[model samples]
Target: MTAQTGYQDHKTDRLARLRRVESQVRGVTRMAAEDRQYIDVLTQINAATHTVQEVALGLPDDHT
Candidate 1:
């Protein structure tokens, strides 16, 4: 079985994602200073992008 609520449920998830993105940015900065692998940094960035997209899609439409 599956269950769902509307935008209310999404709010927490979105905030959590934003926090993760913030952390990732910090990590990337550290990685750059340490001269980490390019592919590793790219993967982290890609994950952050997907998280943003998911949050955007979960938002409710004002017109609806």
Candidate 2:
């Protein structure tokens, strides 16, 4: 699903969303470093993965 238009107006919003995903990834790294329980770490990893996927999927929609 390629977007036919550019997201010029949504640049700020898209960047903000990416920043949030980056933060989520950092949190996951911290959890692992802190020796968190396996399930807890896995849960956070899943959440981060889902967030990234959402952002990726939104790109084409937003551009359109």
Candidate 3:
């Protein structure tokens, strides 16, 4: 793909990943409010972070 196309695709992917991350964060908040285990909540947060990182790493640097 051309640089422009690549960047556009990257932006779309990043936005989608961010939406999922947002939901995961909300889930974590609800879990906390419900007195869920700290470790479990942290695990979910970690997983979300990892997923975001993977998506970011897969994107081309020029896309940023």
Q: Find the candidate with the highest TM-score and give its number.
A: 2
- What pairs collide in candidate 2? none
The whole-model lDDT of each prediction reads 0.78, 0.80, 0.82
Candidate order (lDDT)? 3, 2, 1
Candidate 1's TM-score reads 0.71
The per-prediction tally of clashing pairs is 0, 0, 0
Q: How are the candidates ranked when ordered by TM-score, highest leading?
A: 2, 1, 3
The residue ranges of model 1 lying beyond 4 angstroms of the native Cα positions read 1-9, 61-63
The prediction achieving the highest lDDT against the true structure is 3
Local accuracy of candidate 1 as per-residue lDDT tens digits, 1-64:
7755466645677789889988888888888889999999898888878877877776765124
lDDT of 3: 0.82
Q: Which window of ten consecutive residues has the lowest lDDT sum in model 3?
A: 1-10
Model 1: lDDT equals 0.78
Displacement of the residue 25 alpha carbon in candidate 1, Å = 1.3
